[model samples]
Target: MSTLKNEVTAYLGNSSRIAEDWANYINHQDWTLEETIENLRQMNADEDVMVQVLMLDTMQGISTKSSEKTPDDYTVKYDGYYALNKMLSTFGNSENGSDVCITNSFTNYINGILSIGFAVKVQVTGVDGAREERERNG
Candidate 1:
């Protein structure tokens, strides 16, 4: 049995056949155990992101705007960020000073007037060392 299959079966208590099946699937996708674990960790980290929507109860507005970018690609020129910048710019301001805007709605929902308050929490991760190492190695 492959080491990966053995490991999977040991951790999941799956039958040998099922373990092999899963290993095959994972291999076919060109995904390693390390990458899978990293992806899972990223997903868990994402869950900690809190999105707040504060507005007057009488106002009928929806904040369906958000931007998500990776460490490698985060800028106004990026499509997601571009859209967010454009939309937020309509309100005469877009400088929240937050690293990631999970989601937000800050304009007029009912009429053409803006009237709402919201909170944006920022979580910053330092990848400079990792990025520098990668670049140096490359």
Candidate 2:
């Protein structure tokens, strides 16, 4: 059990790092769906993993609605973070040739999350294409 816990911790750490890296990479660039897909591929990530992360991130925004004034709120937030961490574990293992669909889904998901006013300051910058996609579709 201890070993498993340690493994999980390590995995989470790695995922967090990757997420941060991706966020930073897109911080100043105009990201298109194709460009985002290319960046993920450069990171050795698979399509499914990319889609999963996008989905989890979208969900995380929704989960933030819990009042942070209570301990339960913290717990909920932790669980959402954990789910994102778990999704990161599947990165780089998804099937190829689905980047287009995955990118579209990711854009739609992000837009939906934004529409709820849940991720105003959580924008993934530097992806111009992604921003355009969201604007066009939203």
Candidate 3:
């Protein structure tokens, strides 16, 4: 394995499994606007948290240059960005579960103060490697 891969595995205990678990966890959650906003201030420098953010960025196509993302991927990426900016100013939790809103800051840290000190770099594959790996053992 390459140095980057070895380092990532050492810290994350298996990037593929961490990503799969994250995808499963994220898939089942009802990410409310209030909850997502609150979680942003909870960001930590833990390895697992860093890996989780890496996985999310992979899915959102921020760290990669692939064009294979589904239409929904585009929607989620755009929505997550929108939520980061728009949700903070809005009042009331009335729009928690609304489809028209962006409700996940877990993936929105790209638009926040995410630091380079927590790097867990992975190579960009030609395919939609992020989503494909999740589906393999999801």
TM-scores for every predicted model: 0.17, 0.37, 0.25
Sort by TM-score, best first: what order? 2, 3, 1
lDDT of each: 0.27, 0.33, 0.30
**Model 2 CA deviation exceeding 4 Å by range:** 45-138
Q: Which RMSD values do the candidates have, in order?
A: 19.7, 15.3, 16.8
Of the candidates numbered 1 and 3, which has the greater TM-score value? 3
Error of 3 at 137 (Å): 19
Candidate 2 Cα lDDT to native: 0.33
Instruction: Give the per-residue lDDT digits (tens) of candidate 3, residues 21-45.
Output: 4334444544432232223224323
Tens-digit per-residue lDDT, 16-122, candidate 2: 45545555554446664445444545664533232222322333212212232442431122134443334332332334311211111122232123221111111
Expressed as tens digits, the lDDT of each residue in 3-118 for candidate 1 is 99889546443322332333233333433323432332343333422212221111111222223423332111212334434433432234433222222343332222332222
- Give the least accurate 10-residue stretch of model 3, judged by summed lDDT: 129-138
Model 2 lDDT at residue 19: 49
- Indicate the TM-score of model 3: 0.25
Best by lDDT: 2
